[model samples]
Target: MDHLIEFWPILKRLIKYAIPWKKKIILAFCLLISGATSEVLGPILISYFINNILSKHKFYFQSTLIIIAIFIILQILAVFFNYFQSIYFNKIAVRVINKLRNDVMNSAIKQPIYQFDSQPIGQIISKVTNDTEVIKELYDTVAPTLFRSITLIIIILFAMFTLEWHMAIIAIFIIPLVIVIMSIYQYYSTPLLRNVRYYLANINNKFNETINGMNVIQQFRQQNRFKKSIQNSSQLHYLARMRILKLDGFLLRPLLSLISALVLCSFIFSFSYFKNEVFEVGILYAFITYLGRLNEPLISITIQQSILQQAIVAGERIFSLIDSKKQEYGRNKKRFKTGKINIKNLSFSYSENQKNILNNINIDIPSKSFVAFVGHTGSGKSTLANLLMGYYPIKHGEIYLDDKPINSISHCVLRKNILIVQQDPIILADTFFSNIALGRKISEDEIWKILKIVNLFSLVKSMPKGLYSILGEEGNTLSVGQKQLLSIARILVKNPKILILDEATANIDSGTEKLIQKTLSFIKKNTTLIVIAHRLSTIVDADLIIVLDKGNIVEFGKHEKLLKIKGCYSKMYNFQLSKY
Candidate 1:
């Protein structure tokens, strides 16, 4: 019982989302009560009119017409209130759901990359799509219907008790029994509903994963494997729904009907056993009417229990996400004057218990200097660049920008000055110019200028609509080289001071590599460039080359000097040249 009462607070919080529409709720409630009251009065008035005025002992024509008119009016009024109740309740449900969905999506957006890396994209999408829909059904289907049924039940009880306590005693006697049944069913079904929500999230995650990797599946001819995985997720969802079906199938309609029939029989037996108890005919008729209708609310509540529980479970997930700590942002707003980077005793890891990906690293990158980091796989080259980009927190290092600690700068300010170009770039589904500018208010000429810098002007000019040509998802219409150049053009348009190229040429052909190298050479004179390269030949003229081995810088100098040192850089340089 205590645990059941605990759900009240969660429910109240869900209701808080509806507070903005309090007026509509208030009016809807009033209308519901009015409709219920009018509905219950019908049986009472019919019994009264039949016994007092329409009886053979007292035939009154005008009064009969008046009573009939009043009955019709009450039924008509009930219809009116019922119609508007649905209208306002629907409006409230839609608007409240709209607000909640927007908040969940916005929260997901503000969350840090670690959150996304930890949780699957499909699960997050399920929260925004599936969970919100559950809450909507709660308010739209379960809530309003439950409210009206409960109101009518209350009115019927009051009418029965007012007529005769004897019959009312029987009605109230079955209440505790029904409560126990519903409570037991709810207790078992809540966790099942929770599991249903869980399985749904998994199914969505699997669907998203399969769709996103469809090309890989097809290429490897592993469609059967992916198909089975999807089927398994969907099967788990089906099994969970089956448990709910068992619960509702047993408790909702069949049990309520049985209980209502039992009550009706008990009333009939009580009246029959007390034959000389002087039960009034009119009051007896009313008792039968109330007894026949007593279980409607109970039935409705039992059936909608699954919906209520689903909403509650879904609410838990949705609110858990919304209430999660957002990505940390500093208050400092200082912008970088120069792109110089200084690291003192820097050591970093993706996680605390994990080994440091960059261990005790120290380096100085002067502004407007061309620098390159060359290392074999697991050598921490990309990790160092990411740390410089502020993607991860510095655990054992103090990084300085110009002269101040890097943490002293706000994220917005820091990101405004730095940009990272990776082997795989995000290409939004939009026009060429929009993809390049990306919310920057630069003109067409400026876009063309940056494109020319990246050597993509001719490519865009050859397109059907030039800058206005819509790119497919992931810019699929463009070759890998063209996509990469388009991404670089975007960076040039932003004109950030510090640029990190993290294996940007790893996937492109030699011709594209030369094209990108030319663009790099053109831009190296003005910006701080840190290139993490596998192709050592391209960076032979870098102002400085830092060679990392197992998270430590083993060699640092210009290419010719590093060759003389015959260290890690020398071996890596030799290996690449031999491959060529």
Candidate 2:
């Protein structure tokens, strides 16, 4: 009862998904009740025949045949009703799970960037796939079985009362005993099931991380380490399941069967001693038959407790994800007029407890200007760019795009105006046209023009199908330089107001770097270019360069002005020059 109270909200949310199919669910239940009625009537008809016909020493052949035929038909109707009920219930279950899986995925994609930073990708995947699948089992099997078992119990109790009220009262006591057993199981098993789910999610996270970093692991000979890690996670999951199994072995069927036997003995002994009427063989037979039949549903209810607990755990996980706060966006429809950006006293940390990744700093970027930010690793270069793109909420200070607060802008306007190309750009396994256009209906001629602008025209012309040819998974068919150039083409096609290149030229060969440089020179006239520079030579011609150290802006000027000052920017440039 306590566990039900604690999880009532989650259970209510799961029921809402089924509310849309209420009519079908109602029809299924009607079928279930009809079947249970037919099943209960069978025993009563036989008891009447035994008492009035055989025991009275008067057997009518035609009457007995009719009774036997009616009994057979009742049993057949029960089977038929059960079959159709199962069909309807299963159909509803499949549809509910499909909608739930889609909703989980949609919520996942809309989560804030920081959410992903805190939650592993694999754990999210487990919630969508593994956890939801368990929930489906709840609807498909556990729910229906419990409902059928309960309907049978109720109808059988009614039948027992009609025959003999004394025994009926004794039979009803099984319900409270069953409820007590279920409550005990819930108290002990809920925490264990939760641990099992947590370990399962951890195992999935470990596998995902290992697979993504397989090359690194092999190079460092860390295979054994990862294997042990996964083995430990699996062992924990196994132990939790084993503990539940031990609980089930002690508490579920065997215990319920014992209660059934004890109840039957007390019922028989009381009927013989307390009643003043003479012994009737038919009454004894009917009472014993009803009591024996009652045990089946009682045992079934106990057996379903484990599945119910699992479903509740899975539901809690899925609902927590679905109910988490999505990325907040305002409804302001104002569009960017000049693409100018101003940052005033801006400071940010990923979380409250940590020190700021970008300290109190200030800068203004003019429209259509070529600007560069240079810093060593962890100097908050990418963090600033992330802030500008509105990835994280600004708490300490303000950021304005085109003189309007960035947060006040609507999601559509913000995304359409400001775009960033990361150091490692994501390339899907798709055609050249699809990758570049990104589901937009750009003409082939326009795509060809952008391709030529990025100097990828020759490579596409060499392909068998040109624009329609598939890029292998993660664009494995293309070199890293080619992938980087392709990503640049993707941005240019959109013609965003602001374009950020975060170390885009870091790993590419010099030839590709030179091509990117040339491409940047072409687009700098119209697009506001913000480059997080890796090769300082690539940004020597910028209108301004800002140098950062420990999240503070230590120097800012043009190339010659900064060089004459011989500050952080000059030292970084000379260091790269010396290395080359």
Steric clashes per prediction: 0, 0
Candidate 1 residue lDDT tens string, 325-403: 8866566787777889888999887887898788898899899898999899999998887777776667687888766
lDDT by residue (tens digit), candidate 2, 411-506: 999998889988888889999999999988799999999999999999999999999999998898999999999999988877888999999999
In candidate 2, which residue pairs clash?
none
Query: Top lDDT: which candidate number?
Result: 2
Model 2 stretches astray by more than 4 angstroms: 54-59, 270-279
Instruction: Give the Å error, residue 110, model 2.
Output: 1.8
Could you say which candidate leads in TM-score? 2
Clashes of 1: 0
Q: Please, what is the TM-score per model?
A: 0.94, 0.95
